[model samples]
Target: MKLYKTYEDLPKIKLPKGQEVSISDSTLRDGAQMPGIVLKVDHKVKIYEYLHNIGIEKLETFVYNDRDRNAISMMLDRGYEFPEVTGWARAATSDIDLVLDIGAIEETGILMSVSDVHIFDKMGLPSREAAEEKYLDALQYAVDHGLRTRAHIEDMTRADNTNFVYPMIKKILEIDPKCTIRLCDTIGFGIPFVDVEEPFGIPEMVRHVKEELKAVNIETHCHDDFGLAVANSIAGYWHGANWSNVTFLGIGERAGNAELEKLLLFLERRIEGFDKYDLKSLFEFAKFMEREIGIRIPRNKSIVGNNVFAHESGIHTAGVIKNPFTYEPYPPEVVGGKRAFLIGDSSGIEVLRFKVEDTLHDLLDVKISVEKNDPRLRAIQADIQNLYNNEKRVSCISDEEIQAYVEKYFLFEPIVEKSMGRKTL
Candidate 1:
């Protein structure tokens, strides 16, 4: 059966220039927040080191407000190395000071809500003007304290008033020349094919925002509510985003964030001069997380999942064996995966013979006593082969086909006479 669409024919995307592959692993902060998944200080440091060894740029290890002082202190004391550890925080004077006090201040990025709804309803501020004033105060404070800052616009996708949001962004850029504002779809509400007129849809607003804030950089942090986190993040890059926040395996709150592996895989194919990282270690990292950390790698999950290169049907297996490009966007080996031919009911005689005579020759060589003329022995072998095939769901071949091969090759008589006087057929 045909999938909804082929990966190649889906759409042709154009990635921007100078879009380097940088990763921000949130395993300690966001990934640990998964229900029933928690880590002690040592466990946190271990994962942090693992991520750093594998070449992740930023590691969102913990929050650094007054609320998480002890955890922050312990991590610092443990001499954790690898990733440039950063803390997530609200754009508040006290919160920012708390982060700086705890030594989480180097190159820190603070999230501030630029959406009018947050300003009016959440902050209970009289107007957008007051919120803008507070943001400027926070930005100035961050810059003065020698903290290279990045602003996060919370709930950016659903902001009712881009008229106000865009201006607020411009003001933040003006206050600090080198500041980078992160466009956050906090509620996982952005889409890929958004209309230019849609309210708070990132695709429509990204170009305008980047153009206005040309002096300052732009980043994107999207959610996967509509299964468009990757698309929206790429859209942001397409529209000139300078940075993007990604987590390993897309693990985060709610539907999770854009997966780092998926994002890198996209860039590798779409953007030239972007494949410099050690991608093989990424698959090892994914497996380590799945086997040790207990996070199940979903079958259809992108990049590092188990089924990314598994083929069962005769047609798909044959096509893949002939030319991987017929079924895969890139060779599985590109990301530390290999093609796997799963023997199941749909396997043709050729497929079965390949598995039985070639792959499973050792298992088949186990001697079994049977009369030379006994169709029963051949039937049993065919039945057992069909059982494994059926259980694995052979989608390419029929039972009759496998049975024909078995009857012809497996039912042949022995060359010498046996003690029972049965001659070779």
Candidate 2:
């Protein structure tokens, strides 16, 4: 079935000269916060190392407890070269103290509410001014402690950028010129579509910060409630923001975050000269997390899902067999995946021919040359159709069943010779 729309159809976007976009994998902090996700200390360490090995620019973890603290410490001791370790915490001195005690992270994200609802309703601050003061004080403390800070603006899309967010960011730059300001769509409300306006307008959002707030690196942290987390992050890049905050498999609060693999895949394609990251290890990392976190990889999940490279329909399978790129955006091998031509009720003779000539021969150690129009191919195809229509099999023919068909036709047995004499159907 057709999806609602695709990013492919959108007009090509090109960023200005000297622009840079990098991705930070947040599988430790945001992804770990998902309900029912409980990572052991070793799980955290493994995840951090995996993200580092895959060339993620940064790793964000929350040292909320002993397990997390120990994990962070261990990951640091390993001395990963690519992903500089980062910590996630509220805009409080206590959180900063904990991060300092963890002793290995180079940076930390200090949560500061920028939206009216978050400042007043969530954090219970009397006014935006008071909220900014409190957050700035904590940020200053972190910078004074020699920690690079990412001023995480919660609900940035819903926040007052002109008066509250922009002005506060200027003050943060004064305290720490190297600090990163992460614009967060905490509730998945941001959508970076064409002709969008403020709140969901990513280009406007980035320009609002860059134009007036002084020089600072920008990161996009979006949720998937609207199912546009990845799109919003890409928009952030197109506009001005450089860093993208993503989680593995898009696992996080409620609808989840932008998928790390999905974001990287797009960056490799859309952004020129951005293919340095080692993408092959990403699939292994996804599988490792799926095993450790006890979450099922949805069959249809983007990039790493089972069905992402599995073909079944007649036209799709035939086209894919001819050239994988015919019916696909890119080869499955691009991300360490294999292509599978799934024979089913809708499979065509072209699919059957490929399966017999390639797959079955390899699987059963049988040599056969079944052309697309071979009479034996038609006979076996009729048998498969009969199995589907008459027997009402819930699934398509199995490898064993296909082998049987091949054996019956080519390596004919004496027992079933009478059935063949009835008529060639």
Q: List the residue pairs that clash in candidate 1.
A: 344-389, 344-394, 345-389, 345-394, 346-394, 346-396, 346-397
- Cα lDDT of all candidates, in order? 0.67, 0.81
For each candidate, give its TM-score against the true structure: 0.77, 0.90
lDDT of 1 by residue, 1-425 (tens): 54534445444455654454355666776667766555666556556556655566676655653334555565566564546777666668887776677665376677677677788888898987888788778888888888877787788777754577777777778777787677888777787565756455676667777675573577778878778888888888876676778777887788888877887777776565565455666677788777767778887776787778977666877677666777887777778887666556554433444443432234366544444344544454466566675575435344454445444555553334357675799
Residue 102 lDDT (model 2)? 69
lDDT of 2 at 415: 33
Q: Where does model 2 exceed 4 Å of error?
A: 1-13, 363-367, 414-425
Report how far residue 309 has shifted in candidate 2, in Å: 1.3
